[model samples]
Target: MFINYVKGLLIGSANIIPGVSGGTLALMLGIYHKIVYSSANLIRLKKVKEDTIFLTMLSLGILTSVTILAKIFKSYILDGSTRETYLNMLFIGLTTGIIFKLKQEIKTRNNNNNNSKKITKYFLFLIGFFTTLSLLLLRTYNISLDISEYQNKKSIKYHIVIATSGIIGGCAMILPGISGSLILLSIGTYKEIINIISQLNIIPCTIFGISTIIGTGITILIIEKTINKHFAKFLYLSIGLILGSILQMLFTITKLNVKPTLTLKISSGILFITGIYINRILESTKK
Candidate 1:
């Protein structure tokens, strides 16, 4: 039970990163399905021992990370445009690693079957591409809610709006390929929550946090059920989405500084290559 909670905490922290998802972390940790099942089966707790304990610890970790890191993350988003670009690079590296792993797994599993269809692979790739593209384009809208100003004028209407945004954000978080922060940005609540956190305003932040918990629970329930029903197609789509997200992030902040330094280029290549190498290492360990 303690192990489950601890792991959940770590996963929660990973999910809070702009380009990552709790689901992705859960998948990496090999608990994706189990976590999903646990959440979706919340009502059937009578048959599941210690489910609440696991969930509580996990939730605590997530809460701590979001409150603490939200401000830091927001700083990157708002301050000196370079932050998002750097973040995008890191996520691109991470997603590239995941995509390589996914491809290797698919190949290994299908190697013995000559009758296996190849078109399905391409089909899944396209799904991921389009989904990722949609998120990238969304950045242009500048749509976001600025909730931090509520400290001076806390109203029921503000709470309702924040809660609604949280629900939508929660849905984006559950989907393997979608960026939750980006989704929040689209709905207009991301900036508000960031402001609230940045200013260290507790009341409104707490309200928004509670709403996120409720929203996350409900959203995960539905997504998990759907993934379980269509595992392969969903997996392929997820890979595509992750890949697309990486590309989108790359393009969103694409900039060519005057006279590209050889050092910068070398360092980036190393980071990307190192990321690829890490993927290979993780894969070999799985065997």
Candidate 2:
């Protein structure tokens, strides 16, 4: 239970980062399937006791981490400095470690399959990779969210837009390699929403929260069904997205002109190994 809480914390924190996906972190932590299964089964009331307890703890952890980090990020990391670059480096290491684990899982699962099918799966992997890479690159240029409109009108239209964006962002959150905040950014509501969160605005935030819950519930149901029918292919696609995310991070760092000092490089290397070691420890404990 404590371990699950920590994992939840990491996932929540990852979600706050622009290129990081909470779902991907959950996958890396070996809790993604369980989370999806539990969420999907929530309405059935079967295994109610266990599922409820697990979800409750996980939710608490996520909430705690998000709230704390949101405050910290707003206060310190918003300046777009080397600190943010260093932070991204650490997360990249963590992501790379997870990608390694995911590859091994894919290989083990596909070991029994035929060569042609394996080739096809690899092709699907490439498709997923390119798909995600394109999206990230496009996001760099597009400004979809109209914050001016949001600020000028406090009418039903504003509320509806916020709710709709919340739903979309919530759905994105469940998809591996997709960042919900990025969805909000694409819609141009990311800054406004963050301001609302920072100010603790009640009405708008409440509406957004409700929408997110509804979206997450529906997404969990859909993904659970899909995975039940097509686990390997889905996993391959997920791996591809993960790989794309890693590349995107490297790309962003290069674009930002973050000079990698020797000490920073050494620290990053240690953090990368540590991330792998921690993942292995978590998997072992689960077994």
Candidate 3:
């Protein structure tokens, strides 16, 4: 139980950081499969007391860690434009690591498949890539889900966006190489959701939080079935989503403070390296 709690903290910490994949971390921690299976069963109201306890401990840990870390990260975002730029660079590096790790996994598993299957995989990859890119581009261009100007948080559009963020973030949290926070950033609610936590905005935060839980349950079920039926196909699409988002992340980083002192630049570079090294460490330490 204690171990589960600690694992949850690490996983939650990963999800809050843009470009960090909680699913990958969970996989490294030797609990991804367990958690996914348990979550799906819990959703079905399985009578197993053990799964309930496992999920409860993990959830408690995740909630505790996210509640604390979101405050710290929100401050980082608020500190200065240059600081935010540095964080973005770190995220880019982290994302690059995920890409490499997935590439290795896919390459190793691509054996025993013929040309037609390969073609289908590539097609699915393109679908995931383009779908993700297009959605991200919509947010980047302010065409969707930018409800920052609304004072009343109860507006239908605001709720819709928040609900959507929760659903997306939740599902991403389970997908290897996919960053829940990055998706929220693309949706432009990353900070707002953080603020809700930081400020203890109860109703909306509760809604979002609950949505994430529900989404995770549904996603785990879907992913487990999909993997059983078509494992490589899903990974291909996920890789596409990862690749497409990387381009937008670069663009977003470029939009940040373009002029930084040498010190900030160097710090950003180091953070980038550290991010990559973190993933490398996770990859090497896989369980």
Show model 1 residue runs off by greater than 4 Å: 1-17, 46-48, 76-78, 81-86, 107-125, 141-153, 198-200, 255-260, 279-287
| C-alpha lDDT score of every prediction, in listed order | 0.64, 0.78, 0.78
Tens-place lDDT per residue, model 3, 68-158, is: 9889877766354776777667766777787777777788987857999999999989987786577566656766455667657879877
Query: Which of 1 and 2 is the better model by TM-score?
Result: 2
On a 0 to 100 scale, what is the lDDT of residue 78 in model 1? Answer: 37
Clashing pairs in 1: 128-240, 128-241, 144-188, 145-188, 145-189, 146-192, 147-192
Candidate that would win on TM-score: 2
The TM-score ranking, best first, is: 2, 3, 1
Writing each residue's lDDT as its tens digit, candidate 1 over 1-287 gives 55666666655555555555566655554566766677777755543656666667777776666667777766555343644445555556656777766666666655433334456656877977787677666655554455555554468888788777667777667666677766676566666767776687787777767777677788777767667665655667778887766765565546323234686556566666775675566556656
Count of clashing residue pairs in every prediction? 7, 2, 0
lDDT of 3 at 80: 44
What residue pairs clash in candidate 2, if any at all? Answer: 145-187, 145-188
Alpha-carbon lDDT of model 1: 0.64
Ranking by lDDT: 2, 3, 1
